[model samples]
Target: MGKLLTVFTPTYNRAYCLERCYQSLLRQSNRNFIWMIIDDGSTDDTKQLVEKWIEEDLIEIKYVWQKNQGMHGAHNTAYKLIKTELNVCIDSDDYMSDDAVEKITDFWMRNGSNNVSGLIGLDADLNDNIIGTKMPENLKKSTLFNLYNKYGVTGDKKLIYRTELTRSFPYPLFDNEKYVGLAYKYYLLDTKFEMLLMNEVICYVEYLPDGSSKNMYKQYVNNPKGFAFYRKELMKLPFVGKKFKFKQAIHYVSSSFIQKNRAFIVESPERYLTVLAIPFGLILYLYITSLVLHK
Candidate 1:
């Protein structure tokens, strides 16, 4: 009960920037958290740097090195190992605001309940710009799906989950497919609960050129099954509207075609929508093909 948060960072060959993340954790005003670093088979000096940090014992540091799995895979491992009541992901390229842990636990302890999922907080760029629109002033809680599709808030937001809730829904790891959408699990949880919204920025993000968000086309090419699975799951969600499901269906069709899954027409939940999307799906298929080939 002493530790309230586990600040997890999943890293793969990000040694150069990893120190920055570690230093930020060291500077946190509150030390009531464990910094868990899951090293996803980095061939660089990442292992040594983490070891040195552990030896110094500046903060509670837990290090686990596993075979190279993509970001989602590392996330799965982190969720399993975290014993804290609350958890948040601080990407290797990102760091928390010095008081992030304090702010999060303070809110949770004051008002959090098992009735809700956890907390939904903000993420800011290095320049301190909130990534998307701020949470609605009157709103107190929202699910991941509704906050975007309903409220029209755009851009990435930091999510802090009750570790138990997150652990209950693990990300599926497809063979040779390391790129499952992390949102897949978040959306699944949305059906059961909502998160208390905190308008304060919890984490600072830096989108490097090599990050997953930047090279998505390549990801779609390399991990079509993952993308297809994500889209298919979205199509099955009961809460989303036709418009949202329609978009998921379109992407599902495209990803299905990427895998050359001939049964996509039959597999789709939105039969007519999938049929209509075929033409657009084909265009998207070709567009992705060109991008993959050109790169």
Candidate 2:
């Protein structure tokens, strides 16, 4: 038997968009993967809809529910239960192209994984518009800093990774339920493994009006403590180079300065003060982000 691929979807209160994802999986040209849904405490009819799919037997589905812990928590649960050689995450509101699995599997088969840890692919919206097409060239195996700063790899486009290399995001880092900076965790695997960039578009991300990034400003305003936690974690990444280290430090200090709550700053006064001395923090942030394009 060939190695199984587990496609994990972490969802919360997104019943309306969930079907698009399920339907896409049902139409996949390849059926060697299992669709694992980790429901993060949705009080809506999400469970009913998922159960209906299970009854129809449209695809190999596993529905797991847990108390509301946030996206990372749901991912942690899914990662633990997925018994597949390779794993991928399709957001609840997103779906995959019909040929996505075939393309990914074929790439793995041909490449033979001498040093590849996972695969990355183009992410598009429901309209099939490219999301990060203009990202820096030769971004394959770029550091987390390079990904977010130089290239816009913050979005959900990457594909299945080796189960052994995946790690759970540290729970203490998140103050509320928001999921930011989680992508930084992927850098942990970058040192030993490089990702294969499959020029093909595989995932379709639905831009939900209420998505996490939509309320980013509010998230930062209301949860400065959590934002502070995220900054500290980013600074500690072993794979990040000096530029990202400085950028992360600047981000933390800037956020503290903008929020003006002095609590986290008071707690880490030395670190916070050091960031202000960097001299061109805002300019650097803008320059790095402006490089993203859809080419």
Q: Pick by lDDT: which candidate is best? A: 1
Residue range 189-267, candidate 1, lDDT tens digits: 9999999999999899999987899999999988988898888888888898888887888788888888889998887
The candidate maximizing TM-score is 1
Error of model 2, residue 274, in angstroms: 3.2
Candidates in order, TM-scores: namely: 0.97, 0.81
- Superposed model 1: Cα runs more than 4 Å off: none
lDDT of each: 0.90, 0.71
lDDT of 2 by residue, 1-295 (tens): 7546889998999998898898899889988888999999999999999999999997789999998877767777877788877889998878899988888888878764647677777788778888865345555454434566556555555656877667544444354545545564576566666676667788888777777776565555555556666776767776666665666666666555545645644555346444463456455434433443211
Worst 10 residues of 1 by lDDT: 168-177
How far residue 44's Cα lies from its native spot in candidate 1, in Å, is: 0.8
- How many pairs collide in each candidate, listed in order? 0, 4
In model 2, the clashing pairs are 133-295, 134-293, 134-294, 134-295
